[model samples]
Target: MTVCAIEMTTTAPFTIAADGSYAARLAGDGEALYAERWTLAGPEPYAVPLPLAQPEEADTELLPLADGRVLIHRRVAERHAFALLYPTGAAAGPRTGELPLGAVCAEEGGDVRVRLLPPSPDGRDAFALAVTGAGTTVWRVAGGAFGPEQVARIPGRCSGGVWLDRVGRLLALDHELDGTTKAVAVDLGRGGEVSPLLQITEASDDRLLLADPDSGLLLIRSDAPGEPRLGWGVLGSSLPVRFPECLRLGDAHPFAVQPGQALMPETSGVALRLPDGRIGLWRPADRQVFRFGAPAGWLGGTGLWSAQGRLHLPYATPEVPCGIVGMSLPPAPPPPVRLDPAPPTPTRPIPLQQAPL
Candidate 1:
């Protein structure tokens, strides 16, 4: 789907805000984790002026707070602790004291923690579906205010979850039970009750990629479609979303889009397996896919969508170790007027694997 390809110069890799104004990165000093915030809007962009410094620990995971602070999870021994960094200087740029996440979050054990719960609609509050060895839990993280507070703990073992509504009220999580993965919804309004969301009659992990509240549109990649191809399903609607077997959306952002927020809705650039397994972006909106001539060692081939629907992907050439770049897609091309063309021959419905769809 070639419209007009714009040049994307490489830069640092960071998690961008809803509007792509600022970016955040997790910096580690071997013992401590630092939350580095940069203003990508100013002339001198990517400068980590106001950095949040966390207490020294063995390992740390950082998530950006809406108010520019950070929600830090520090792993000291077997005890799992949470803290809120104010990001101080003139602004709250860095460092923190102990602000435990109560008794529930004191253990960050097992295979996974919070995977993707999407930030609040206005970027003020953040929600996450935290998965531990015990079970999966939902936590509400508010920047500049409180640490991670338990909203509700889901039933059974699960991978992660996504927000289904614009106001961050509804959530959909991938629950693993009985040797199969099912999409279940945990209605926060209903006291964290779990109900079936998307279910396939097979053993597969159907993770929610992006759910657009404005249109109730869902993009999911699951092994149910033979080999985890990109498929569409509508929220609150029982109708199944079906796609051809030839398409395989490569490993892209499986994280949920922020409430009333999307990196790119109208168009998306997904990673794909092409040109000797190089990273590529698949635009589902237009059924067009393009590959970038990025140097080897791209950031795990995960593509990001910006506020304006621009594609920001990490690339590393031989000269540059790592950097991020944004691809501005031109408007969708006009459809060609119909003229009766020769009918094509029928072919077998051969299933194919497509990554980054």
Candidate 2:
């Protein structure tokens, strides 16, 4: 099928707010930060320039905070830090904080939770959260106010981390162990106990790990084969159902399905990744599909989410530095038109009356 006449623009990191508004980032030509907001209703996007208090370099890890602010992870050689950027004029200066981990990954919630390798004198592996707090002494101290927790120290590198629940009780860790890679879900609230959710014995790489906050359905990707394959299972279940067939159905990259959204009970959402790597908004109930194109060189690995009734894609393309490209789903297509073949042309009438004359 040919792509319909719809143009997709490149966008930066974006998130759907509680009120259904979308907040996205756009860096200007000179690398100045700007924030753009768009509504679900069709309208031209509006942007606001954000000023940097400190002359720090660009940080790619942009996460939206629950309190309408954005968290940026800044790396300076071996030192890692974080800064909070409020919307437009909400705050005077950027809130900066130092972290123990050489690198930090953040997830916003009631509090901005950062997963960073803890400061270990012996070079042991650790992950911890640096919670926002009071003045210098109150925040500067490590492991006291909001410090690092050594969850599971393995022999190799820690690949991925995600919170399994709202309260952050269960932590999912993707790490390499015994020359193999696996995803292990650990109960952090009870203790640092770990249990295997999915394992790969052969030479494989875990590309992505996504957990539904509501349903607890865990989706994982493995590069055991040349291309990525999706596998999903319930939180505590060991039996993972591999959707190898889903991968064969075109360029279907995995998109995250929000809780309580319209989705297949077995699967989530009506969206399907086409063979060409474009996302099709699908409604299996209605048997309808709408296609949306991504910016030129952008791959679908960027996280896609449907929250507050809008489809938000935090994609990075070669054209646009960073922003969220969103498009509303159009109404279902009408029934196919049927055309009957033309009736056979009538032959020339015979002139028998001329013979009688």
Candidate 3:
């Protein structure tokens, strides 16, 4: 069995699309960043740029659309700002207008957070998480012709949220209630009823990083191992395996995974930045860690997990502008383990509090 890989050199970082068949890059020079969208279905990847323009600074957050468009978000004062970027090449070079997401969480101040959750499994709409004074709200990003629709909301403080399904029908939110923290599943189509999703034991702190609704596979980060480390478990099949805490030391974010497939042999896992300024990969299933043999002086931050279970990392050396290495992986068989649900351990009685950010 052969797994295809894609590598390219550029000046900007990239985020892969949900299905792993596409990648989007925002190449910036000083004040401006251009978008480069690559189609990966064929042997050769064809790329195109949006109307060259500068929106936010280097820290601009990006979300790739199902139809090959790009979404950009930045915080402007107290409001969450968003703009829908249309690739000019998709319509023969004439760039379409950027759709205004307007101000989300405008009334909420102090790091009003907004995040791009996993897109719909069918490659249709994308979802965004916005924290406002009212509560945590999830908005569906349909397209240019339509405004974002609020599909779900968590009544109280919610953090460490992740999609529980690829179709985005279900979402898991980390909730702190009665002085303890655990994750709860929210049915967007329903009344957002909160149900226990992940809780190893009330004695430990845990949160879901990525979860596959079908396989019940979830990549979790928990303090159960005595320190913050990687833990993975199947919903109802096997016990979770926890890795050493050092695997996540100096890590910028949790491991990457496909929106639906969570773990795959050929896909990339979490990227780690060592104390010596080196980077590495975390394979929880293998219980081993390996660093990328990237070119010297490669900057690291976050990466994308493809549907094929491959991790796509963005790096830049002093000599090269920007590029990506799609770490290849042979198709791995499904994990044989499962986690049996157990009654949650009891925590001291206290007022329900929001999980810390």
lDDT of 2 by residue, 184-208 (tens): 6556544556665554424665533
Local lDDT at 121 for model 3: 61
Lowest-sum lDDT 10-residue window in model 3: 345-354
* Winner by TM-score: 3
TM-score, ranked from best to worst: 3, 1, 2
User: What are the per-residue Cα lDDT tens digits for candidate 3 across 1-357?
Assistant: 222222224444566666656666665566676665666555655656664444456666666766777776666766667777775435464564577776565552445567766555656666777775566777775542456777777766678767655565667777766656677777776866667776666666677777555445566667765666656655544344444444556433454554344333222344544444444566445445665544432323445655555666555544444445566444443554533442222121111222222
| Candidates, ranked, lDDT | 3, 1, 2
Runs in model 2 deviating more than 4 A are 1-26, 33-48, 53-56, 87-155, 200-208, 223-228, 237-240, 249-252, 261-264, 270-277, 280-291, 295-310, 313-357
Write down the worst ten-residue block by lDDT for model 1.
343-352
lDDT tens per residue, model 1, 66-175: 55655555555444455555543444423333244532243634455544344454555656566666777876655324566677787678765566665556776778
Quote model 3's TM-score. Answer: 0.71
- The global Cα lDDT (0 to 1) of model 2 is 0.43
RMSD in order of candidates: 8.6, 18.7, 7.0
- Prediction 2 TM-score vs. true: 0.57
RMSD after Cα superposition, model 1 = 8.6
